[model samples]
Target: MPSLFSWLRRLYSLDTLDTRFTSSASASAQTAADTRPPAAKDARANSIAQGARAPLWRTPEFFVYYLFFITMVPLMFKTVVDASNENNPVYAKYSHLLSPGWVPGRLMDNSDAQYASFHDNIPYLVALLVAHPLLRRVYNLFSNRSAQSSTSSAAAAFDAQLEQRMQFDFGFGLVFLTAIHGLSALKILFIFNINYRIAKNLPRSYVPIATWVFNICTLFANELCHGYPLEPIAMALSPGSGTPGDQGTLLVQWARTLDGFGGLMPRWEVLFKVTLLRLISFNMDYYWSLDYPSASPIKKKQLDPAALSERDRVKIPAEPAAFNMRNYVAYLLYSPLYLAGPIVTFNDYVSQQRYTPLSITRTRTILYGIRFFLTLLCMELILHYIYAVAISKSSPDWSIFTPGQLSMLAFFNLHIIWLKLLIPWRFFRLWALVDGIDPPENMVRCMSNNYSAFAFWRGWHRSFNRWIVRYIYVPLGGGGGGHRPANGKPTGSPPPSSGLGAKLQKICNFLLVFTFVALWHDIDLRLLMWGWLVTLFVLPEVLATMAFPAKRWSSRPTAYRVLCGVGSVGNILMMMVANLVGFALGLDGLNDLLASLTGSYLGLAYLISCCVVLFVGVQVMFEIREGELRAGINLKC
Candidate 1:
């Protein structure tokens, strides 16, 4: 009991973790401190010219993981089939069409209609992974002679630009080749049978000639999603009515247009959806660029007053432009990350265009890639098992579940949801290495490595977090710790940080940011409930930290150190529980479950006791693993 009190006294030791997400430059510096240290050099590599060559592809760990992943494709297919619960399933077609002995037929030429449509992509993605690197290497070889002997400033500048990438001719050559092959794949695979259109209830049909007719509708259908005309109309009519007026009433119309097809569109429209932020970033930077010329082609063409809607024209005023067709095209279709992404800012995307990227280590990069690949495989298998065993609510074995089982279910379900993204996110980040660009890493660290909501947000989906920071948070007056008052700095003394007003503002801003993120993930009732519930506890959590600030107690006795260590573990466990609860439960289900926790005295006591045990056990587990408290294991960040 005294020991628990001791922990309360020294609780602030974990303050080195994630601070508030702020746009302030100082806050940015603090966030960097949380990132993993860069990889180290291998001395044996330096002896062979620049470096010892990485092992051949056959022996490489990355190659092994890829081979293993392919081996498990059958199991993945079976899981998908089982989850679908169809009378005549997709995988059933696979066995009928495929020959076991013939590997290519089994993998690619399978007679399965779905697989047949998808087979072209299997080859295309593989070629894309290799083509850019090999082509760039070839370009470098041929251009070495022509790059010498240029004395003019223009030539130097041009060479400098070329050095950032392979020569311009090759870049365009690769682009045209990819675009041709890409268009063929889209036409053959995506365009047939599926009703790709604005009308939601339209049945599937074959139309070779008119797919583009629907494509045009799909593009324009998005104007309604953005609340373009509705927002402008609402503003004109309502003026001071901050409520959702015409635009607010249209959410269902908007949801039906997008969310009705969200699942099918994840691999299709999701590419365009994710890249929208990059476009916004590009437009904003062009608007603000000091050197942008008024008469630039991009300005005259894309931002023409007649071309943009009223809302867009007002919100995104024309800035001078310096157009680079290659950069803009590549930014949109950066094939490695196009399917799913870490949402690279336009600046990072362009800055990486340089010909030389020093961080490309064949050995280290491949090793990291293999690590992610294997981790992803394990997580995916876990999810597959969980789905098979646990997802059916009406199963006859429902009586076998316990409260403890429900807790674990919550844990695994949330992990499954997050792992779905982590698996693909990691694979693409690895693939991006072939392009010589290290897009920002996601899921750098999560779960036990974090002990607070702030830390969790900072660590997970970091690229998305960055986009939110740059485009949303900063724009909305991001937690500026100091501010000049609009009402002119109340008469005498300045306001202090500890005041009730400041505290409420801090909590409000944090919750508001999280709500925005939740809504962005999906505009669903379940997610909205989760976001608000999680935010409810996080406010009190911030208050707890402020109340019991950490103290080192360096010269104090062993008991004090032990108390602090145990308390830190308790905090971590509690935080993770809240996260799982937030993510695990549905809108109605969460309310019922939370109510049951405290509805009975026995239930309340039992739940509290379980938490206490888990809290202390976590500290003991870490000590057993690391020989000290909070000794974090390094990961492939």
Candidate 2:
């Protein structure tokens, strides 16, 4: 097999992969350029010879893990939001399940259960995934025995053949999922207490069985239930919603009309949802793979037997997927991210699992642990503490705060939203990192120091953005880095940025992407509006930066430093204000915002004045720094 570098070169371009890994490189350079991180040089060398190892506890994660394991954490932390919990009828019934114990559950009534229906199932999934080491030991006993058998080589070859044959066919995928998940589905359906809660707190001995089944009937397999999933099915069964190609009514007609494409609108729910895109990506990337199964092969009955081509008789196959069922299942069902995901591509995941076994090091562990801790601090201190205080004071009364104050509220609120994502998302990403998968981090560095619209969206829920680019943007002829102009650009497409057509194409692509984001988030008008607001912001920001670009401050470090500090604050202001328009408005808040827009326009002027004051204040403060020149000296100079 080729080295990882060679494989990446084949998947993407030589430009995307480091030039050091080029085929023309000398043998020694090639060897050295094949760097796999989170692994020691020696450990990497022995990875093929040995097996995968376990992750260890480190800084921040260690603290959480230790507390969860040792302390009476269940009893220590309880947030009683409603008085109903004190007198709740279900509380007495499920009290034992929620008792302070290992993997404790929560007692929730009908009033508060909606929020947790999905979130709560994750802990059960996590427990099973955490028990993966135990499962591996059992599998190893058999694998070790197979290694000693004379027929092992032949068996491996057969398995390789099987992997190659199981291409992108929905029938095969459906059958695979059905076979794997059938038993667990029965358990979930038939057995009492074997529901989500019982699944989480299931007896340790029975966990491996249930978990294996869960992992096996995989989400990655069935290809998003063909005509999309749940929502579409409902729409199709509804009285007036026409079939996909046929728009039944005004709502359906308008939906199909939105993107100038019929499918994206009428079955808008299918296109507008978030999780569905991940499934769409899995299908697209799987089929896009080299030597994969072609679209549902023409049936034998549909073909004239005499004229049946060679392609009909023997199906073409993609390169062998190289996925053992065990590892494939593990990637699909890895618990920490099973609920809150930065979904890893199967190819990246399998490569990490098979070729790059992560060596746990003190430095790596501590670094990951510290990040986890920082995320915790941001979540607790900024979101829980600050947001709670802010939310309590916020109301519909327009006179409560000036425009400047509302803008400030928007800034803090956007940060709170990003921080909220960090809680579960960071935990999921950190778990995968410790295991050595390098599953793309969700929030990336956006929350830390993002300054531009491009940087902000790219950093937030980053994996999904990648999925969109790979499966949607590039496929739709949007060209940029890693994408060639000819990939899908039409014959009459604009030649360059100097042309009007080129600018229009850029705008079109921008709007389409954000529109998709709107749909993905929800079919809500506010979200679509939000998407457009962001699109407008990013496009101009990109153009403005490109047009009258800032001076390259490499020669003047102080000036550049000041520019950066100012830019950070500006970014927050723009980000928050846009979010306020698109998302952060309620009934009273909406009235207040409208009042600012319509009445007197004084609030708007106040907002502009406050921003000016803020910028000038920063400039003055920087100029007057004790180590540098003071403001008084600057007036003379």
For model 1, residues 1-637, the per-residue Cα lDDT tens digits are 9997754433321211111111112222222223221111212212322321223235453365455446544544444334423232333432333323222322222222322232336456567678766766676567655666544775355345544363443354335434544332242223221322211123223231233245434444443354222334444454554454634435434533543332322234324445455555554343233223445433555543222321222223232221244455455556677666867665555444532233345644655555665665565345333432233222223223334434454545555556655666766777787566666667755343444456567668887876766555544445453222223322122333566666676566667777866655555566665677667767655676566444544355345535545555556555555554455444444445455555667667857755654444443333333311112222212
Q: How far in Å is the alpha carbon of 135 misplaced in model 1?
A: 3.7
Which residue runs of candidate 1 sit more than 4 Å off their true CA positions? 1-127, 139-267, 291-325, 388-400, 479-500, 551-584, 591-606, 617-637
TM-scores for candidates 1 onward, in order? 0.56, 0.52
Flag regions of model 2 displaced more than 4 Å: 1-129, 141-275, 291-318, 321-334, 357-363, 382-384, 387-395, 401-408, 434-436, 446-448, 480-501, 550-571, 586-637
**Model 2 RMSD to the real structure?**
17.7
Lowest lDDT 10-mer window, candidate 1?
A: 15-24
The whole-model C-alpha lDDT of candidate 2 against the native structure comes to: 0.43
- Candidates' C-alpha lDDT: 0.45, 0.43
The C-alpha RMSD of each candidate to the native structure, in angstroms, is 16.6, 17.7
